[model samples]
Target: MTDAVDPPAERLLHDLGITEPGEIDVEVIACAVGAVVRYRRLGVGDARIVGLGDRAIITVDNRASRVRQRFSVAHELGHWHHHRGRRLICHGAADQQVGVAGCEREADGYAADLLMPRFMLEPLVAGVPMSFDLVYQTAAAFGVSAMAAALRLADVHPAAFALVVEEADGRRWFRRSASLNPRWFVRSAASGVSVTADRYGLSRANATFAAPAQRWFLGQGAKDAQAFQTIDVMVCGRAIHLIVVA
Candidate 1:
């Protein structure tokens, strides 16, 4: 064996208290098997994600504190663990396009997978009464950021759910799975409207949406609302524009 994952490399999952690591175990195995032949190199910066010769590169904002750095590190680890053959380079997160092939989006997904594995999260959140408080509590149990927890909760919401992120006191992130259907902008109609409008200010977590005309909040309609079961949630104490339908 020319080289391996340095032992502690795999411990990141353990440190996070993840026992069964799920696919991460497979990733670790691949990293171990490939580390000898793959010949990987790792570096970090606040630049767009890219791949060099046998290495994954990461760029980060220097003025930013450790959380971003740590997240970057974990992100780079994701590239190394899951997408090893490719030389990965990242500019961290940018103005995301609402479609696939988003590196930032992939990194966010990978980070969630690594830190909050299905093995750990699946059992904890099951039947855990959907609520912003409940979601936050589950996230705390996993030792991940509230936003991370919120994202996971939104991603894995049982019936139908979506998560909204607000930047500058407005919603900036939107996520909806197959179980949900939300126009979300029948009120704004703008291409990218700030989610902090007074329309959402009155919104609270666990609120259900079945509204007829309203897209942001739960409407009281039974049929239209039956299309999805919408719920509201918040992130980092900021309002999270949420919708769960059908």
Candidate 2:
């Protein structure tokens, strides 16, 4: 499992005296780390970083959403912190894959810790039930996308849950809650639980409902099927399902 607290980013936050979500100013943080963030019209990628010694320049696409731009800047800061004196170009699909490069994954993890620090996020999610509403609320509070919020929630929320993202083409990726058992693996699909759009382009969203454990959990008995529940949300041609053990 990836460490929930990024020592460097967390130490940076602490050193900067950031104690709340509103205090996570990516540009200011970048400046503190000796990187100057700039916005430009990019034809290829979402963001890039070029660094020499301690000073660096991070260029992010100006056309992206505010949340995305912020995340992009934070991601480049991650690169600047870890892989300094190097150049890298990153894509905009922040929640697209689990099998990314080691360095890219590192940067993504750093960005997550920077944007939604454990100190601030864990308190809000503790003892609260996992659902779409909670995810959206967290997103709104942190100025991040729902997908980013969901992934970070899974990382910090003390629950046995898994977030599954199914693409329009049926490709899937998932992030497991920290408390989830490693022995339990997620299935490709849950039959009655419609994660993607159907023939009429209709999909389920904004509600938690029952789904068979066998349908979502691999190698589960019928007796255990009733203990599982799911909340589905649709975003940008993708379907995200929050599977929880009740």
Candidate 3:
């Protein structure tokens, strides 16, 4: 019996010689799907598909400096190949994308899995040194953006991880996985709400500090069942740290 989920998208990624980061083939994917592949400084795109009824339109905005349009194009093509006939529009920085669960998130996962397969990420993450420059270089090696690399590392790497992005003005959106067991009780004294990455990582940072040390947590079923860890990272630039605890 056929599995409920489609495996062709992933299978094509591997078969197309894109089993690593830098090996994305935007042109090929564009040709295959009859989509137009172009580069622009248009702010954001992690594979956005304009799924008009009759045919699907795919476009990848290469505006961001961190990741290449190649991966973006491939990412869009992921939606085209697997999610054809469905209108999928992905906006914002790959890191700051809105909503936690649903098609957008699923497509993002699919994009990462396709562009930076576990096979390549495992060995690469295991062997490579961790640093901003080195990390950027690795992302370059994979032909993906730095943020994209960080996202993948957070998933497969055993170390505790957190990705912080700083835009022109301040902190944007940041997500910490289970490995990053942040302290949950430390609610903001002012707002009384749980502090998120955008609150500190980008929004508030400015002239003074280069790096900040803070803690956050991921809550489980019960209030007490929260995971916590301390994240020490840079104030600006895209920072991904291998935290101490898991």
Clashes of each: 34, 0, 16
Error of 3 at 164 (Å): 4.3
Highest TM-score scorer? 2
**Candidate with best lDDT:** 2
Where model 1 places Cα greater than 4 Å from the true spot, the runs are 1-17, 20-70, 83-88, 93-100, 169-173, 181-223, 226-238
Runs in model 2 deviating more than 4 A are 1-6, 87-89, 191-195, 199-203, 219-228
lDDT of 3 by residue, 1-246 (tens): 124453455567656656544455657656655777655546454446566553555655565443545555665665666667765456622442434456556656767766666666667667554434545556667777666666666666655545444334433445454455555322111123343344456434322222212333334422433222222234335333322222
Candidate 2, pairs of clashing residues: none
Candidate 2 per-residue lDDT over residues 1-246, each given as its tens digit: 235555688779989999999999999999998889899998877888888888888888999888889888888877877877555556643542577876788888888888888888878887898888888899899998888888888888887888877777878888888887677777766656555645324344554577666567765353375544544545566677778876
For all predicted structures, in order, the TM-scores are 0.56, 0.89, 0.60
TM-score of 3: 0.60
Which candidate, 1 or 2, has the higher lDDT? 2
Which 10 consecutive positions of candidate 3 have the poorest summed lDDT?
184-193
Q: Write down the lDDT of every candidate, Cα atoms only.
A: 0.48, 0.77, 0.51
lDDT, residue 59, model 3:
57
